[model samples]
Target: MKQPWIHNAKTDWWFILSPPFLVLLIIFVFQKQIQGLENHYSFYTWLFLIVFVDVAHVYSTLFKTYFVKAEVQRRKLLYLGMPVISWCLGIALFQFGALTFWSVLALIAVFHFIRQQYGFMRIYARFEPDNWSKKIDEVAIYTATVFPMLYWFKTPRAFTWFVNNEFDWLKNLPDYIGVITVLYILIVTVWIIKTIVEIIKTKTVNIPKTALITGTYLSWYFGIIYY
Candidate 1:
C-alpha cells in the first residue's frame, strides 16, 4: 500500500504550486503598504545568494551521504559547526551594517542548515526505526518552520507595518500578544526537549545522528539564549 502522506504526480504539482500561491496571496493582501517597506537589496543579489546556497546545500547533502556510508565523523563536525558559524557571520554582518536583505537571507540559511541536519537525522532514524527519534524529528521540523516565521514577524521592519496600519482585523487584539505567543512557543519548546531526551535514551550513541541533533539543539539554544 502507498504511504498516506505520499502524493501522486498531479497532487505533487499542486503541492509545488502552493507556496508561490500563498506568497502571492500574502503580497496581494498587503499590496497597498508593502511597497513602503525598505528593500535595498537588488533582485540579482537575491538570486545569486539563493543559487550559491542551493549549491552549498547540494554539496553538503552529497558529503553527508558519503560520510554516512563510510562511518566518518567529519560530516558530523560540519553539520554541528555550520549553524554556529552562520550565527557568528550573521552577527558580524549586522555589526558592520552590511546589506540588511543579505543578513536576513544569511540568517535564514542558518535556519535551513539546522533544518537539514535534523531532517537527515530523522531519515537515518527511520532506517533504524526509533519512535522517540521520529517524534523528536517531527518536533524539530515544526519548530524549524515556526521559529523562523516568528522571528521574521518580530523583526523591527516587519513589525512596523502592523504598528503603523490600523487594520480592522488586528486593531483590537491584546497588547500582550507577543508575551502570549512567546509563552506558547516556550511550552512547545519544552515538549521538544522532552522528546529529544527520549530519543537520546533510545539511541545513545548513533554518532552521526547524535551530532546532528545535538548541534541543532545547541544552535537554537545558544542562538536565542546569548543573542
Candidate 2:
C-alpha cells in the first residue's frame, strides 16, 4: 500500500499555512496605513516582519536540526559554522557599501524564498510515485513563486525586500512582465488541470501540495499587487 501525499490531515496542512496567510492578509489590508504607521506604529510592523515572519521562521529550523540529534551530529559543521561565516560575509558586504549589502542580501533573500517553495514542493511530493508528476509539481510551484518576483523586477512596486531604491534598476518593461505573467498562468492552469485529472482517476488529491501551491499563488500575487 502507498502512503498519502500529505503526511498530515487537510486541516493540519491548512493550519500550517494559515498564520503566514493571515499575516500577509493583514499586511495587504493595511498596506496604505503601513506607510503612515511607519513612525507611529513602526514597532508593530517590526514585530510582524522581523519577529513573527523572519526571525521566528529562521529559528523554526531548530526542529530539523537541534531537536533532531542525528541531524545535528550529521551536519555539525554546517550547524556550527554557517552563522559565523554569514556574519563575516555580511560585515564584508556592508563595508563595501549599503547598495552592495542590500543588493546582495535582496538577491539571496529572493533565492531563499524560491528554494523554500521548491523545498516544500519536494516534501509534498514525497509520496508521488511518478517522476513526471514530481517534475510537474516542481515546475508549478517554482513558476508560481518566481514569476511574481520577475514582475517586481521589471515593474516597480511600493514594497521591496529591504530598502527603497534597491530594486528600482528596471523601469517600464511591461512587455517582459506581460510575457512572464502569461507564461506563469499557462503553466499553473495546465498543472491544475493535470492535478484534477489525477484526482478523477485516483479518487484522491495531494492536499498539502495543493495548499502549498495555492498559498504560494495567493501570497505572491497579492504581495506584489497590493504592495
Candidate 3:
C-alpha cells in the first residue's frame, strides 16, 4: 500500500526522467545550436551547462512535496542544495580545465557519498548500531572511490564500454591473465552480486528501486554497450 504522498512524489519525479520530451529538447534544440557556434566556450563549458541542467531537473523533483509543510520544506531545500552545491563545485572544476571525465567521476562520487550518508543517518536515527552504519559508510565510500578511479586510470576501456561501448583501448592491454580491464570487470561483477545479496537479505526493496532508477538513467549507456 503506497502512501498517497509517495505516489505523488514518484509521479512528479517522472518529469525529471522524461527523456523523450524535455531531455531531447535540451540535447537537440539547445545543445546542437550551441555546438555549431565558433565561440570561445570550451567543451568543458558545454559539459558544465549540461550538468547544471541535470541538477535543475533533479531539483524540480522536490517541488512535488516542497509546499506541504514547514519541516518538509526545509528538508527538501536542504536535500536539493546538496546536489546544487556539488554541481557548482563541478562547474568550478570545469572552469579550471580539469579532465572532464575525472571531474564527472568526482561529481558522481560526491553524489553517491551524500546519498549513502543520508541512508546511514536515517538508519542510525532508527536506533541502528553505530558500527553498522560505520561499516556501510566505509564500504560505500570505498566502492565509490575505487570504481571511479579504476575507470579513470587503469581501465579506461571498460569505462568507455560502460558509457559509449567503444573498446578501442582494450586492444592495447597486455595479453596477460591479470589485465586491469579484466580485473575491473571482476570487481564490478562481484560488487553487483554482493549488493543484490544484501538487498535480498535485508528484504529492502528500496535498494533495488534505487538501482532501477540508476539503470533507467543510464539506459543509453547500457544500450550502447550491450547492443
Top TM-score: which candidate number?
Answer: 2
State which candidate has the highest lDDT: 2
Question: Model-by-model lDDT, in order?
Answer: 0.50, 0.78, 0.46
Better model by TM-score: candidate 1 vs candidate 2: 2
TM-score for candidate 3:
0.33
lDDT of 2 at 23: 64
> Considering summed lDDT, which 10 consecutive residues are worst modelled in model 2?
1-10
Please list the residue runs of candidate 3 whose C-alpha ends up more than 4 Å from where it truly belongs after superposition.
Answer: 1-150, 153-183, 212-227
Candidate 2 segments whose C-alpha is farther than 4 A from its true place:
1-7, 20-40, 60-76, 170-175
lDDT of candidate 3 over 1-227, digit per residue (tens): 22112234555346432442354455545665654541556556545755576456666766665655765766876767877998888777668544554546645754664464345334423433456533543344344334443344333332231235233344466654246446545645555565577667877534323433333324332322222
Q: Write the per-residue lDDT of candidate 1 for residues 85-187, one digit (tens) a residue.
A: 9888778766754455354564465567656656555654555565754675566645644454444334432322212432222334455547745864685
